[model samples]
Each structure stands twice: as structure tokens, then as C-alpha cells.
Target: MLKIRNLSASIDGKMILKGINLDVNAGEVHAIMGPNGSGKSTLAAVLTGRNLYEITEGQVTYLGKDLLTMAPEDRARAGIFLGFQYPIEIPGVSMANFMRTAVNEIRKFKGQQPMNASDFMKLIREKIALVEIDTKLINRSVNEGFSGGEKKKNEIFQMAMLEPMLSILDETDSGLDIDALKIVANGVNMLKRPDNASIVITHYQRLLDYIVPDFVHILYDGRIVKSAGKELAVELEAKGYDWIKNHDGDE
Candidate 1:
């Protein structure tokens, strides 16, 4: 559903992503593993058009559309969901209100009528259950005073509500306890469909245990240097990133 070729990006006049090439088809899960500063998150930011990173070269096509030309909100409406590595708190905005507005906006973009209050409430309740989020939290401000796990789960909850065609989950496993990790992974697994895909970016292999990937890609120095199966995650864990670093040679 998404194709990228020789994609490079930079921020503050300094280059980050040198050349990234990836193609994600429906019903597939791709895991990107790498050490710190390897541009995993940078790739996500570039795809989502975060406004800081400037695309210096290459192209990204999503569902046959020029994804780079669209605004970030338009991209979200086009079914691109980005689960942030560090979800920021938006105080004074109730989760219900925040999500209701977002959903309605997306609906408008699709030329559909806005969901009624009653229907939106029902939908939110059902989706919150899918992520095992507490209803009490919904009434509170978005990510306000929430723990790390709660923020990550909230991101998944938003993902469930939006039902994106391609989900970019960047370090969704970070700062999460085992229980929280399992809950997040289970939600992602349940949301998987034949017409959607996911790109999971993580440092540790533990997350892969719960959400098995069809392809495991080792992203180093802003480029995907190695691509393998799920077994690659296990090897990375046992051998560490240095093993790949020493052998692969720097760009």
C-alpha cells in the first residue's frame, strides 16, 4: 500500500535519513530494528510530514497517491496513522472530545456525514474496550498525568478508532512493562486485517515476540542494510547490534 525509493530527509540543515527504500503491501507486518540514532524515528517523521524534516530526495507513494504532497492531516485522513515514540500530553482536552473531532474531520474528508454524538460515544466505548482502556481515562484530558504505558495504549486506542490503512508504530514497546506490552501487542494483533499493513519500529526483540513480523529489516545509518525474516530479531538480541555494525561496514 506504500512504496518509497531512495528517500532522504534532513532537519535544521543537517541530514538524517540518507536513503531509505521500503515497500509495504497489505496484510504484512514489517519490523525495523536498529540501535539509537539509526533514523528509524526519522523515517516515521518524514513519512508523516512532521514539518521539521525536509525531504531532500526520492519519492513516497501511498495507495498510488503522492503522499509527500499531502498535508499531515490529509495523510491521516488518507489512512496513515503514526504511533509516536513519546506521546505528548494535551492538557484540558478530554480524550473523548479530542478523538471525536479527529474522527469527524476524517469522515468529512471522505465525504461522509459526521457521526452523531450517540454513535460517536458508542464507537469510542467499543474502541476503548479493544485497547483495554479505562472509561475513566476517556473522561480525562488527553495523556494528562498518564503513565508511559497508558500513553502508548492511548495511541493504540486512537489507532483503533481511526482504522488506518498503514500504521507506523515507532517504539510502541518502549517504556512499557510486560503486561502493558502484551496489551498493546494484542490490540495491534486484533486490528490486523487483510487490507492493512503495519511497520513496527523497535529496539528490543521482545515486542516482536507478541507481534510477529513478516519481514525483519535492520535499519542502520539511515539505510536499511539487511532484510530477513522474524528470526533476525532473535539473532540481533543474542548477538547485539555491534555484530551487524562490524560486519556491514559504514556508509
Candidate 2:
């Protein structure tokens, strides 16, 4: 569903990603693991077209079209969902109204009629249940005064509502307790289909236990240094990222 080749990006004239290459096919989950400052989040930002990072080289094709050329909103409308590492708080807007507007906008982009109030309410209820999110929180402003776990679950809730084809979850497991982590992973697993894919970027291997990936890639120093199967995550857990740095002769 997504193809990236020799993709490099920079921000404020300092290059961050230096030649990233990967392929995410339908029905697959790819995990990106690395230490801090390794360009894991940079890859996600580049793919989602965050505007700050300029693509220095290479190409990214999503579903056979030039993904890097599309606007951020266009990417979202084209079924690209990015779960932020730090979800921002919108203090004045209710979650219901915010999501309703977003859903309708995507539908309009797809040339479909807007969902009616009754159907929208039903959909909202279903998604809230799917992610095990608190109903009371939905009536409040987006991420306003939410606990860390609550904010991450809210991100998954939005993901469920949008049903993006390529979901790029950047550190979705951050700050989540075991129970909250399980709930978030369950929601992501349940949302998986034969025609969609996920790129999970995380630092710890514990997240991989909950959301087992088809491929585990070690991203180091703005490039993917090693790619392996699910067992690679287990290896990384046992050996730690220092092993990766040493193996790559960084010292």
C-alpha cells in the first residue's frame, strides 16, 4: 500500500532522515524501533507531510500515487492517519463536534453525502465502545485535561472513526499502563483488515508484544539499519539498542 525508497528529509536545514527505504503492503504491520534521535518520528512526519520537514531526496508512492506531493489534508483524506506522539489539547471544541466535522469532511472528499445526526451519533457510540473510551470524555474538549492513557485511547478512537487505510501510530504506547496498552492494542488489532496496513513506531519492545508486527526494523541514525521478522523484536528486547549501535560500529 505504501512504498518508500531512498527517502531523506530535513528540518531547519539540518538533515534528519538519510535514505529510508521500506514497503508496507496490505494486511501487514511494520514496527519501527530505535533509540532517541534516530529519526523514527521523522519518518512518520515525512510520510504524513508535516510541512516542517523538507524531502531532500527519493520518492514515496501510496497506492500508486505520489504521496509526498499531496497536502497534509489530502493525505488524511486519502486514508492516511497519523497518531501523534503527543496529542494536542483543543480546549474549546467538544470531541463530538470535532470528530463529526472531520468525518463529514473525509466523506465529502470521497464524494459521499454527509452522515446524518442519527447515524453520526450511532457511529460515535460504536467507536467509543471499540476503543473502550470513556463516554464522559467525549462530551468534553478534545484531549483537554485528559490523562495520558485517556489521550492515547482518544487517538485510537479517532483512528477507529476514520478507518484509515495506512495508520501510522507514532509511539502510541508511550505513557500507557499495561491495561491501557492492552486496550489500545486490541482496538488496533480489531481494526485491521485485508486491505489496510499499519506502521507502528515505538522505542520499547513491550508494545510489540501487544501488537505483534509482521516485520521489525531497527532504525538508527536516520536510516533503517536492520530489518527482520517478529523474532527481531524479541532479540532487541534481550540485547538492547546498544547492541544495535555497537553492531553498526557507531562507537
Candidate 3:
């Protein structure tokens, strides 16, 4: 569904990603495990057209379209969803209003008429049930005064509503108890389908236990140094990153 070739990015002229090449087919989950500042978040930023990062080189193709050339809104409309590491708080804007706007925007982009109040409400109700979010919270401001877990759940709630084909989860496991983690993971798993894919960027392997990936990639020094199956994640957890660094040096 997505192909990234020789993808390099920089911020303020300092290069961060060095020739990243990755491909995600439909119905697959790819996990990117790396230490802090290994360009994991940068990759997400570049893919989502965050505007802060400059694409020094490379091409990103999504669903046969030039992804990097598309605007942020276009990317979202094209079924690219980034579950942010730090969800922002939007005060004075009810979650229902915010989500309805997003849904309508995508619909407009696809040349469809805006959904009526009744139909939109029905869709929101079904999605809220999928994410197990309270209907009352949807009536409140987006992410305003929400607990950390609640904010993360709200992100998934939006994802469920959007039904993106390619979901890039950047540190979705950060700052959550086991119960919250399970809830979030269950939501992600339930949404997976044969025509969709996910890219999970995380620092720990614990999250992988719930959402097992088809491929595990280890990134270091702004590049992917090793790629393996799920067992590699357990090994990294056992031996730590230094082991991989030393092995890479020997190679």
C-alpha cells in the first residue's frame, strides 16, 4: 500500500533520515523499533506532511500516488492517519463537532455530499462503540481536560471514525497503564483488515505483545540497521540496543 525509497529528511539543514527504504503491503503490520532520536518520529512527520521537516531527497508512494507532494489534508483524505505521540488539546470545540468536520472534509475531497445530521450521528455512535468511548465525552471539547489515557483513546476514536487505510502509530504505547494499553491495542486490532496496513513506531516491545507485527525493523543512527521477524523484538528487549550496535560494528 505504501513504498518509501531513498527517503531522506532534514530539519534546519540537519539531516535526520538517511535513505530509508520500506514497503508495506496490504494486510500487514510493520513495527519500527529504535532508540530515542533515531528518526522514528521524523519518519512519521515526513509521511504526514507536518511541514517542519524538509525532504532532502526520496520518494514516498502511497496507493500509487506521490505522497510527499500531497498536502497534509490531502494525505489524511487519502487514508493516511498518524496517531500522534502528543495529542493536542482543542478547547471550546466539542469532539463531535471536530470529528464531523473531519469526516465532511474528507467526503468533500472525494466529491461526496456532506452527511446529514442523522446519518453522521449514527456513524459516530457506531464508531464510539467500537472504541468503547463514552457518548458523553464526544459532546465535550476535543482532548481538553482529558486524562492521558483518555486522550490516547480519543485518538483511536478518531481513527475508528476515519477508517484510514494506512495508520502510522507514533508511540501509541507511551504513558498508559496496562488496562489502557489493552484497550487501545484491542481497538487497533479490531480495525485491522485485509485491505489495510499499520506502521507501529515504538521504543518498547511490550506493545508488540498485543499487536503482533508481520515484520520488525531496528533503526539506529537515523537508518534502519536490521530487519527481522517478531522474535527480534524479544531479543532486543533481552539484550538491549548496545548488542545490536556492537553486532553492526562487527559486520
lDDT of each: 0.94, 0.94, 0.92
- In candidate 2, clashing pairs total 0
Candidate that beats the other on lDDT, 1 or 3, i.e. the better one: 1
User: What is every candidate's alpha-carbon RMSD to the true fold?
Assistant: 1.2, 1.6, 1.4
Query: Candidates 2 and 3: which is better by TM-score?
Result: 2
- Model 1 CA lDDT for position 189: 98
What candidate 1 gets wrong by more than 4 Å, as runs, is 249-251
- Taking the tens digit of each residue's C-alpha lDDT, what string does model 2 give over 48-120? 9898898989999999999999999999999999999999999999999999999999999999999999999
Model 3 misplaced regions, further than 4 Å: 249-251
What is the lDDT ranking, best to worst? 2, 1, 3
Q: Which residue window of length 10 is worst by lDDT in model 1? A: 242-251
Candidate number that wins on TM-score, 1 or 3: 1
Model 1, residue 168: distance off in Å is: 0.4
